[model samples]
Target: MKDKQAKWCPELGDFAGPKYRAIVAAMQRDIQSGALPPGTRLPTQRDLAWSLQVNLSTVTEAFREATRLRLITGEVGRGTYVLPGNDAVQLYAIDKGGNHDTIDLSTIVPARAFSSEDLRQSFATLLARDNLSDIMDYPTPDLMQRCRSAIGQFYQPRGFHPRQSDMFPCAGAQAALFAALQWIAKPDLPVLVEELTFPGMKIAARQMGLRLVPVAMDEKGILPADLDRAARASGARTLVISPILQNPTGATMDADRRAAIVALAEKLDLLVIEEDVYGGFTKEPPLSLQLAGRSILVGGLSKLVAPGPRFGFVIPMLEGNEARLPEQNFAIDELVHVTSWMAAPIMLELCCHWIESGEINRHMEWQRQEARTRQSLVRRKLGLPPLGRKPAAPHLWIGAGQDSPFAGLSGDQAAAKARAAGVEIVPASTFCAGRMLSDGIRLCATSPRDRADVTEACKRLRKAWS
Candidate 1:
């Protein structure tokens, strides 16, 4: 006498970790998505296991984990109910005091920069291939070879060339990071990172039981002296670095600094992990840490080609040791097994076609141009000076300088003003590593759908804060 079909049962898509943990995580994702709102009743363990076609013990363990997170309640002689998470609810608030229209700049995503272009030709060409069936299957060694070759070719002109034998396609940047963590970190080991870095890396580090030690940085980027001190002090063998157009703070290291950091890495015997996701957007990309010595360099198409696919690659560098690739391949195999080894065949073919036909280069140019134009618009319309800016970088900052008029305003206060203006800006705390240097906000230079939207948002920003 109940609607079984309508009840919450997780669609556990190719996820890593234990089955029980996956269940808890999936339920949390659903709860945060508002699919299972507060006070909603969940099916009993037996009912859920029967409905989901899983073992009873799995459901019981899942329910126990969910209860531990305070995401659900188990009542005696009654049923389970979703718990309240007001903080989580605030994340997806669309209606701002009764308005549905809002320009979101809080998310770090590439804009649809290229206009007058369509994917019809891409798909048509892909569909016309004779080996279309093989493309959809899990990544075989042959397809991986082609993908790695394509990735290498794309990066060759940019100064960060990678060997195809060492490269393998991953789901995304985070996937590569997870594999790196598993290979380098043990329980309770310390890992060094930029004071302000990608938040996803921080989350992954915590999940892997690695402690993130924040290294100091200067205007040009991570200070070599501080890195040495931290590396020696914490005895951290692994360091995660983003050299070009760093997130939250748009710092780009010069050649001298890159060389210095490399020297320190060799001296300290550090295992370097370079995240060069924004490499193509920069005019003079730095040499990848892989070139220096033993390291891991992550490359992805999501930032350049399009944001739709979870397409990325990880290259394990050991300076042609011949013995290291096998171990690295083993780690990659584990990741692939857990994450479902292949990207969609269509995505793989599209990337290859773009690389072979040289169309991806044109797309990259357009994205860079679009990003610069947006940055200029933000400066002119909002009358805000950009801090830590680089050419064609997709994100920029508006900091409160010591003697500036806006010094009294906190990042949260500034963000609230932008929100009232129907725009959402990321707060400073979102990127804080160990601490914050100043109160500021990061604005996505290429997130809005169009220039007019950003212009209007800037106008509202000026009216509210300036």
Candidate 2:
């Protein structure tokens, strides 16, 4: 037993003097002396008890003390391991007196409270379906039909009566967006986007060899006057806008702005691509592509539902505008795999069940209420204005002033600081196109379950700002 203990630290001290403090001091000495390197797994509680000739409970207490010191991190089913040094030591250190668990504010996702047991049951039911073996087979029309039916049912309440022929399921909204861009915009042609927009659209445009033109935006969204000027000045005939919950800014287009933009698109002969990823969350989103005359509406289940669903519906413009799309589009060709599409029926059925049972609406209402409360707390704590409207989406946009402490830091710097403080955030630059610098950052308020987490996260953010 003494030999096994010596493997950790050959020079055994008088650990029997005071069980708790002695064990803690020994572990600290080993760490300082580099006997326990970063990422090194610590001995099991049982083994340590046997080696130290202490009871299992004493070993457990020692291990708990070490964990409190942030000398190690433990994952369930995985043994404890040492943590790396850095400011993360202060932020992640167990003795730091704050939550070390990461608060992911980067991705805009629905709150966990919004998820229902019915959804899980639906997934299980889908997995138990007859001919489940066939789902592993390659893509086929039967799979497409099933997915389309499920998708169509999902959007029926949104007044979109899409047929199986019209619906095309992709990996997610990102894939659908790429396909739409390829089909609509000519290579090297300037495509118009909101001054602040989804970062993925910019990346996709660059990869597709399309130039992105940032149209100016007002309180409502992309200003129609600026859209006209950009369209005429740049001769750009393609426009991509997130009519609902515009990324980074959280500005949704109202009726007047929507009508004006639609009119401009018609006059400019532009192909309008409305990416309404959060359409399901809203009571009534803007007019669908079918109403826009010559537009493409991209809807997905990733936002309102679980992202793992990987199901999206692309409703092309009315019959006559099919020629406007590219002849050989990969989005139109590479249909969703049978297995991926199989997940659709389960999601749709779950959504339907939740909707009928009033659980979905209730859950959404609770999320909206909780989100608003959290957003209000963030506003009060950070001394920032409100970023979300009454519906209260998952994320909020924070404007950091030039003289602000965070102003000197870059986006990555801000993210690193926030992460070091155990709160993750997406910088404003993540949403901008070109080399434009933004004086803001997007904060996602979806994770915190109580006001305490929100307050602590805000306090950490204030420190990061300083």
Could you say which candidate leads in lDDT? Answer: 1
Q: Which stretches of candidate 2 lie over 4 Å from their true place?
A: 1-100, 114-120, 289-291, 322-369, 385-389, 402-420, 435-438, 448-452
Report the lDDT tens digits of candidate 1 across residue range 1-466: 1211237777886567888888888898887887875556788889989977889999999987776555665444346666444232243454434755788776667778544445777777888978879875776767767887888788778666666667767777777777666666676577788876676675676577665666777667799998988888777778888888887777788888888988888788777788878877876654454346567787687766676767777776767432422233254345455332746666776778888788888888888888888888887776556533556677777775544334567776788887877888876645544434335778786777888888887777777776
Model 2, global lDDT: 0.64
Of the candidates shown, which would achieve the greatest TM-score relative to the real structure?
1
Per-residue CA lDDT of candidate 2, range 1-466, in tens?
0011224522346555657567777877776776764546667778877777778887788777775555554444446665432221121222322445766666676666644666676567657778666645654566656566766666666676655676676666877787677665566667788866776676676567666666777657898998888778777777888877777787777888878887877778777788888766676644554344567777675666556656665665645655553343444444343223434444444444454555555665666676778778888888775544555667787656565447777554777799888887776545654323244677778755557877888899888768
Instruction: Output candidate 1 Cα RMSD.
Output: 12.6
| Candidate 1 residue spans exceeding 4 A from truth | 1-99, 114-117, 289-291, 320-342, 385-389, 402-405
- Which pairs of residues collide in model 2? 70-94
Overall lDDT per candidate, in order of appearance? 0.70, 0.64
Report how far residue 201 has shifted in candidate 2, in Å: 0.8
